[model samples]
Target: MRLKDKVIIVTGSTTGIGKAIAKAAISEGAKVLVHGLEEDLGLQAIQELGEENTVLHIEDISAAGCPEKLVELAIKTWGKIDAIVNNAAWVVNSDIGTTGKAFLGKVLEVNSIAPFLLIKSALPYLSVSKGVVLNIGSVNAWSGEPNLLAYSISKGALMTMTRNLGDVLPRTHSVRVNQINPGWVLTERERQHKKQDGLSENWYEEIPAMYAPSGRILWPSEIAAAAVYWLADESGPISGQVVDLEQHPLMGRNAPKDPSTIHGKP
Candidate 1:
């Protein structure tokens, strides 16, 4: 019950890591608002987590006014927000030449701009609560992943925002801003990419060792654990830092997933 009596709004929680985070938060006694494009899935989350503990908000984060609406709903329902997790994202696997302006714009808008708006709207409530903002970033924020150029740039911008907001927000308001850079997650997207690349069914098995040196693709559960740790009160002294959850590329290549070789140590 680390988040006992807390209120949190997680964007795009119908599936994937977002859903996992919402589920975890609820399990720890935080009333959660589940948001995403899938109305059915969002409702399902409310049902799964129990209607009393979870609320569903079906919307597209990419839309213009959705972010503010989300914050408003959280306040109306819970009286305050203890945390806001900006986990919604749009991704494109294309080089700059292969990606058109429209695609790039969409990527940046959803990945960077939308999160900014969400934070801006939530800042007032967060300031009063002295809340935390947990941004879900990616390893691509640092990696030069050619195929995911726009996606990388957008995430990189988010990482910068986390740092920028951390400095400015605390001085004027009490809210703390930080980010988590999830490693190569074995999510639906990764599975699809494996199939697209004609990789073996065991592609994920090799991924942890091959790409991350951890010999394990990060599961949604693991990421949720990290998020919860950050959101909880113990992390009050921690802010303005991006926790890189992936293994160091060079060290990871040395002995993938050899628990001893992997660096999960804080």
Candidate 2:
């Protein structure tokens, strides 16, 4: 019960890593505002997390004033806010040639701007409670693959927002902010994304060892476990930190050479 009596808001929590974080917070004795765009998924989360301890908020976060509305609903349900996990994001495949102005605007609106708005909307409550904000970022922030140009840019903006707010909020309001840049998580959405990219149903099984370090990609639950540590007071008053959650070193690591190519056998 590390988070006993705390109230948390987790955006985009209807599925995947966001859903895992909501569940983990509740298990640690926190009441949560579970948010998502899908009503059905929101209902599923309410059923799983229990109505007594959870509030389901359905909204397109990129819409105007939705962030403030979400914070208001959390306060109405729980009387205060202890933390907010800005986990909702919109990702679409687009390279320099394919990324249009409309698409780029949409991507930035959801993936970058929405989180900033959520934090701003929740700032008053967070200050009152001396709360924390955990932003779920991506390792792709560090120059994503060419195909992920717009998405990479959006994440990079988010990473900057995290650090900027992390430094300012803690000093000015006693509210902490931190971010986690997760790598290659194996969620249902990810599986579907791979499928859309022409990967077969057995794609996970076919991932080369070079990609999946532990014979598998990262899991939402594993990310959730790390999140709880930051959300809880056990992490102290630390802020302005970005953790890259990946098996391989994010910096100064040589690309994995193909075994067959190196051995000249195949």
Candidate 3:
């Protein structure tokens, strides 16, 4: 077990990539803190993973004092925190020009600021365990996501935060910080987008071949594998790096060369 006896906190664990990461962590013999705003889903995750291995905490990370409380709970329950995956973020789908000020603020608060705050709160506990921090970024950060303007901006901020945190963490405390930027992952929210746009869920199926050169969308499990790896001591030398899960074109500047090699070197 890579994470034997370790305790991890994964926010937004009720569903999507967050759910997959939480389950994977549990499988690797780690005690997982399942966090989210949904009480029922949190309980469901607890039940699915078994009460002995998982604990459910219902709280909005965007809320003030919430990050500290969460870290406190993890310490109180398990006596230590080995890793933290900042997987909580969301947007209602609006471009910069169209998005309201409140919407933009909300996006940054939940997607960007909250992650930073959580890291700060968990630093002490993480330092004791020489733990790592895995923040969830997105392909939208670099791509021209006209529809997700605020979200993109927030993710962009997250990348910068990941780097800055990594740089300072090692010098100050032994904690390491990094991020995983996943490409067009088909989460429930992403599926809703396809349904709303009146398109096939597999419309982007050829994207990996046509655009990504990988030939398919990134599965939640694949991303979860990377997260689990990063949580272990093996990822110590990989701090401050932004692991892009997007299938970058295998050809010229931005063109696909081969679909089978989408997971190849960038």
Candidate 4:
């Protein structure tokens, strides 16, 4: 019961890492407001999590005024908000050639702006509760793959927001903000996306050695497990921090042309 009696609003809780975090929070005795798009998926998640522990709110996270509405919904349901997990993201592939201003704008709206607005909306209650804010970011924020240009920029913005809020909010409002940068989680969305990209349905099972050091990527549950520590009082006064959760060192780790044969030839 690490999170006993806390009320957390988890955006994008209908699926993937967000859903996993909501589940873990509930198991740790937290009440969760599960927000997401896709009415059926939202209902399904609520059913799985049980109405006693959660309430469902379905909305496009990027829509205007959504942040305000979500804050209102959580307050209405739980009477106070203890924390928020900004986990909703708009992920689409784009490169230098395919990228456009409008596309970049929309991606930033979902990934970075919404989280900031949500925090702003919830600030009052959070101040009262001395709450926590956890932003779900990608390792790509450091500088992403070429194909993930706009998404990377959006995440980079989110990362900066996390750090900025983490610094000021904790001091002024006693609200702790932090970020988790996850690398290649094997979530439902990941599997689906890879399959859509023409990979075999079981592509995850046979990942290249360079990508999956341990024959697998991180799991949503694993990320959730780490999330619990930061969300709970256990983390104590730690703010303005960004943690990278990846199998290997993210920066300057060499990828061999043929690892099995080129072991000592680098």
Candidate 5:
């Protein structure tokens, strides 16, 4: 087991990519603190992962002091901390015209500020264990689709934090930080989001090839697999990387040409 005896805290892990990461860590013999906003979901995760291997933490991360509380619980229960996966996020649609100060602030609080607080609170323990921090970011962090203005800004800030911490922390504390920016993952949350936008129930089957180059979007498990590498000792002292997990090249690539243009349609 690559992560044998490690103690990991994964926030927003009741569902989607976060849930998958918690399961992966536990599968590798790590004990996990599975966090989520809903008590029922957290309890479900604890049941699924087994009580001996997991602890359920229910909290709204945006609330003050919640990040520190989570870190304290992990230490109190397990005696030490080995890793943290900052996976919780609050995503909402907001174009320039629709975005307001309060809306933007809320997004930043949950998606950006909470992660920083958690890292700060966990720093002392991380230093002692020489642990790792894996931040779950998004491809939308680059510039984002116009509709996701606030969300994009928050994620972009998180990417910056990941790089900044990754560089400085390892030098003195031996703690490593890294981030992964995933593109077009298909989770239950995504399904609902698309459905709200008027997509049909079977929308996944109808995604254009231009958007889903591999005939499908990414799965939560795929992201989990990559996370294990960064979280485990096998990775060997690497940090300060922002990996874009996407099929298309994220930079210096032309947009896909229209098929009709090739056929010379008038």
Candidate 6:
């Protein structure tokens, strides 16, 4: 019951990591606003998380007035907002040639700008309640795969914003902000995405040692578990921090140098 009676808003909660976080928050005695664009999936989330502890919000994060509406819904439903998990994002692939200004703009709008707006709209209430904001980022923010150029740029911007606000908000507004960057999580959508990319259905079972030091990547629930600490008061005044939730160190780590261990490309 670390988050007892807290009211949280988790965008993209209809599926994947966002849904897992909503489920975890409710289990800890919190009421949550589960948001997603898919009406059917939002209904499913509402059903699974229970109507008593959760409310569903269906909208495109990039659309105008969406952030304010989300804040309005949360406040109107529970009369208060304790935390906001900015987990909604556009995860798409595009290299240099494919990533034009519009592509980059759209990615930034959904992944970074929308989160900023949500925080701004909820800041007044959050400051009054001494609430927290958790941003779900990605390990790819530290430069990224060639195909994820625009997404990486957007996440990098978000990481910067989180660090900037993490310091600014806590002191000026009395609200804390922090971010978690998860690496290679095994979500349902990820399984389907990989299969579409020509990987076998059981590709996760045979990950390369370099990619999965523990013979597996990570799970949505595991990331959700990490998110709770930031949302709870137990985190104290800690702010302006970005934690990497990967199996191993992402920087300056040399591979085994064994070509035999590397079988084929992903």
lDDT of 1: 0.85
lDDT agreement with native, every candidate: 0.85, 0.91, 0.85, 0.93, 0.92, 0.93
The TM-score values for the models, in the order shown, are 0.90, 0.96, 0.90, 0.96, 0.95, 0.97
Per-residue alpha-carbon lDDT of model 2 for 107-220, expressed as tens digits? 999999999999999999999999999999999999998899999999999999999999999999999999999999988899999999998997886566566645678999
**Clash pairs for candidate 3:** 208-213, 208-215, 214-262
User: Highest lDDT among the candidates is held by which one?
Assistant: 6
Evaluated with TM-score, which candidate comes out highest? 6
Which portions of model 1 show Cα errors greater than 4 Å? Answer: 212-214, 249-266
The window of 10 residues in a row where model 1 has the poorest summed lDDT is: 257-266
lDDT of 1 by residue, 129-217 (tens): 89999999998898648888989989999999999998888778888889999877877666887788899877766443345555677
lDDT by residue for model 6 over 1-266, one digit each (tens)?
Answer: 99999999999999999999999999999999999999999998999999999888899998999999999999999999999999999889899999999889999999999999999999999988999999999999999999999999999999999999998998899999999999999998999989999999899998887887677789999999999999998999999999999988899887666523634443
lDDT of 4 by residue, 92-173 (tens): 8999899999989999999999999999999999999999999999999999999999999999999999999899998899
Of the candidates numbered 1 and 4, which has the greater TM-score value? 4
Q: Candidate 4: TM-score?
A: 0.96
RMSD over all Cα atoms, model 3: 4.0
**Better by TM-score, candidate 6 or 5:** 6
Total clashing pairs for each candidate: 4, 0, 3, 0, 0, 0
lDDT of 5 by residue, 155-201 (tens): 99999999999999999889999999999999889999999999899
RMSD of 6: 2.1
